[model samples]
Target: MAEEKLLEIKDLHVTVDGTEVLKGVSLSVGEGEIHALFGPNGSGKTTLLNTVIGFARYHVTQGSIWFKGQDITNATIDERARLGVGISFQRPPTIRGVTLRSLISFSSPSLTDEEIERTAERLDAREFLDREINAGLSGGEMKRTEMLQIILQSPDFVCLDEPESGVDLENMALIGKAARIALGRDSFDGAGCRSIKSRRADYKAGLVITHTGQIMDHIFVDKGHVLMNGEIVCSGNAAELLGEIRSHGYTECFRCAGCAGRRA
Candidate 1:
């Protein structure tokens, strides 16, 4: 049986600030699956995520992006958000005046104050709720807040960039818990108490970019793709691919015709 694809990109070409960053890139993330994207620095990993989320500066010169059977190649960021697409940025900027609690409230208005408090408690973020958005936050704190926003938004598909970057093992575990809830891998109120088997059909989908592969310790990744020099040159089992990359750097991928042939 074939998996139902939730997000698809066909031969995507994107440029940032008039310089091409992605070249003929293509991939699909299926319903209830999480795909890890592995690449070296400046390998267009972040570029791909920004493009998928409809960031203005990432101009798509060719190809199409489809979500839930609709072509959204030219959709605005707000339109993408409305269509159940969300992103957790690698380095989220600080918003000087907006309180984190107020922002979360705005994003998910139906949840009562108590419900918000409980959710914050689950992420170990109750103390930071009153702080200004992304202001004076440690790397781990910012990542946890990103997960909290994703959980509250409850998007059908999400793109997370470096969720484990710059965080210690302790906070990494918390981020993982929040991610599981966001992806419906665990029940919202009871993080690890319930089985996802009962809710498999409606589980959220995700694409996560990782340079270190440490995020794998927290979440299940069904597949992986390696992007190099603006093109995807490898695709395979997430853990195995990570192992190979760790043993031999990205240069080894160039020798494997089977992996590099994926784009051909």
Candidate 2:
């Protein structure tokens, strides 16, 4: 028997400001699997993530979003989140008075104070959590905080948009470590390790959107899809697709008649 599906998106069509952004997009993710969405800038990667999380501005004119076994095409953002869907925005918002600690604690009340502190430390977000949310935070700091929230929430499915954008050589390893912990790898010590492992077991599905493919090198990306003009043009194993993208950008792979003919 095949593994049960965790997320199902069928004939997904989305438009923003009267301009079509996603055209007949269809994809599925199974439990315990990682699916990578790769595309050039403005290729609708973020649009798809927003649509999955029920962003109101991007209208889903047609299609449906199913989670676990329920149709959630019209669910609100908070509704989807409570139902085990979480998203880390490519450009996270900055709330003036909200502290990172408060926001994270509010989202995940199960975490102990020490667990939260350890999580922040692993993501290199220990310093910023006490500060205003995303206020005066560097790009890497914002990314780390986003990763921290996903870890704490332990959602069934996570949507990560450009997870490695602002990371530099110095802190890239730390970010990668945190991502591995979220993916269920056992590398930490004490309660942190146990908590992360439990979260990993609970986190059965994910949609990772990346441009540089650097994240794939660190984590095991199960499948990859190439997006262009708001549509998936090609899908393949993570290793093969990452190689193609690295050698030649999305233009060469997405536009090639031969590559486009094959399904992901």
Candidate 3:
């Protein structure tokens, strides 16, 4: 039996600032599967993520986006969040008045104070919970805090943009572990491992965008796609694709003639 698809992007064409960024991009992520997206800078990688999360600036001029079989192409960000879609931006904004603890609670109202505290502690972020969200924090600190909120949000589908962009090795490891927990994989205490079928039934899925592929060392990714010139050119095993991209660069992907009009 095959797993149900959690996210489907079909022929997506997005425009930002009056210029098209995503050109007919399409990809599908099955429940319990984590897909890695690799592309050079300015390849519309972030544009695709922002568009999926329903950012207004990323206008969808054509195509559709579906979540859990529901058409969410025109859904508002709040509506999408309520439907269990959460995203961690590459460069999140700072809210001077709101503390991290407050934002985490707001992200998931059902989470108890103790539960939030435990998650923060697990991420080694207990000390910063009372501080303003993303205000005056170091690069690694910001990434870890973002991961903590993501875990607390506990969304069924997670879209992480460059989670390992500026973090150090130690912080990257912590972020990776928290990411696994958010996706219903292993937890911080080294337990809570679930089978792929079980995870799928629970609707846990993730799509991570990375340039260095360092995060792949910590979290398990089912597949990878190369996005260049605003289109996915190759799709295959995550590790293998990463290796090829590392060895020959994205120029190697041009040989495949792009994944146009085909589902990943």
Candidate 4:
């Protein structure tokens, strides 16, 4: 039997405000696969992720978004979330009056306070649990906290935006580890040691965005996509594409308008 397609965006056109941000883009990540989306600033990477997960303000002017075989072009954000889609934001909001402790408890109703403490401790977040979410948190702290939420939620399809954006080396490893754990790649070693999640990880799929591409060092990527000027200029081997970008920058392989160099 063939594995089901976990998330699919076909010829999607998206606009923020009156201006179109994504001209026409298509991509897919199958069950248990992780796809890396790479692009320069203003290339529509965040717009695409925000669209796929159905952030209402990002109106889809044309095309379709299908997740787990259902077209969800017009689905509500909560609808998409209930269908096993989860995202760790690059800049998570600072919700007033909601402590991280309360947030975690809400995410996993069955978890005991003791287990929550252990989870927070593992992420070195014990101190911030009582703090308002994202309130006074450093960039790295915000990333880790959101990752912990995603782990607890155990969404089937995950979207990671700039998982390594502002973190130092230590937090980068922690964030990477959390991402791997969310995607089910860090579940167990050959020696049978467990990863963070106590339950054996269910099959998970992911769409990850990277500016520095550091997250790729931790999470194995099955596919790579380049989006420029609101469209996907190319899709190919993740490692090869990243190496190409590193060697010559994004222009060396972009096919979009106003970009020069060979096709990526």
Candidate 5:
């Protein structure tokens, strides 16, 4: 049997300020799979995520975005979001005078108070929700808030950009737990230790973009792709590629094999 495709990008080309950022880039994520995208700064990781979210500023000069078997290349940001696509930005926006509870309640009206508290507690974000969206929020607090949104939305596909960026080691485990919950690996209370096996049976997919591979250490990443100069230089299994990246930095990897002479 063939695998179901959750997202498909074909020959994507993007430009910003009249300069091309993504050139002939293509990628696919299947249901329930976690795929990591690794690249150095300015390699277009965030730009790619922005394009996937249908940001009008990042023009897709040529390409197509297929989500859950439908063509959404031309869809607006709101349109894609209504279709169960969620994005956790690298720098979450601040909402002045808007409490976190209000924001979440506005986005997801179905969540009960108890459910909201549980989700917030699991993500270590219970205290921050009472405050403004990002007012005086520490790095960890911001990440937790983002995780809370993920739980509330329960999106079919999620794109996380640099989730571990400013998080400390103490809160890293909680972040991992939240991600597992989103992936359906284990529940908020750790009831389903065996659910990791069952979680792989579902069709929830995640696209993670990272500069540091710290988050990959906590989860089971299925595949890894190296992005350089706005395009994928090579693809490999998670362990092997991660190991290579650990032993040798992006500069070495770029000159190793598939991307020796590529220019941005």
Candidate 6:
């Protein structure tokens, strides 16, 4: 039997500001599988994620994006959000007038104050809760803020961009824990030991874009793909592909992916 696909993109072409950024890209993430996307800077990795959730400026010129058997090629961002699609941006914006506390209510209206405070503490965001959303936050803090939203809302499909970037070792563990919570997985063992299973077993389906693949150290990566020149050029074992890219660089990915035509 084949795995159930939760998110599917077929020959997806996207144009941003009149420039074609994603050219005929296609991929599928299985239900409960965490897939990692890798690429060099400006390779359309972010474009792919933004387009999936209907980022306004990115016009889908061709193909279709389907979530859980529904075509969302023309769905509005809010429409997609209502369908349980959540994304944590690499750089989130600051909403000067809106406090994170209020924004949490917007994301999960029924969440109690106790639940909010506990997640805040788990993400080291107790102080940030009262601050304006993303206002004066460090990169790590911004990432944590986004994670907090995703956790409270419990989105079915999570899109993460570089959750490990700018995060210290201590904080990386916390971010990983938050990711687990968002995915509805066990974060701790019975004896109070953090689960060695953070990167394994039950998980929600989603795609993650990783520059350093450091997030893979914390979350389970079932498969990995390399995107080059706006197309997915390679796919393989998550950890193994990450290791290959680390040792030989992305040129190795192009060579191995049989994408020599795009290398120049």
Q: What lDDT would each prediction earn against the true structure? A: 0.87, 0.83, 0.85, 0.83, 0.82, 0.83
Among these predictions, the greatest lDDT belongs to 1
TM per prediction = 0.93, 0.91, 0.92, 0.90, 0.92, 0.90
Candidate 1 structure quality by residue, lDDT tens digits, 1-264: 987788999999999999999999989988888999988999999999999999999999999999999999999998999999998988999999999899989977887889888888888888889999999999998998888888888899989999988789877777877777777887655636245556566778999999888888878899899999999888888887888788788888546554554432
Supply candidate 3's per-residue lDDT for 222.
Answer: 90
The candidate maximizing TM-score is 1
Candidate 4 residues 1-55, lDDT tens each?
7656788888889889988999979777887788999999999999999988888
- Model 3 sits at a Cα RMSD from the real structure of 2.7
Write down the RMSD of all candidates, one decimal each. 2.0, 2.8, 2.7, 3.8, 2.7, 3.5
Which residue pairs show collisions in model 4? Answer: none
List candidate 4 segments past 4 Å from native: 1-3, 188-202, 255-264
- Total backbone collisions, model 4: 0
How do the residues 1-264 of candidate 6 rate in per-residue lDDT, one tens digit apiece? 887788999999999999999989888888888889999999999999999888899999899999989999999998999998999888888899999999998878999999899878877888999999998888788878888888888788999888887788878888887776676564423222135334433467778999888777767788888998888878878787787788789877557643434332
User: What is candidate 6's CA lDDT for residue 198?
Assistant: 49
Q: Would you list the clashing residue pairs of candidate 3?
A: none
Clashes of each: 0, 1, 0, 0, 1, 1
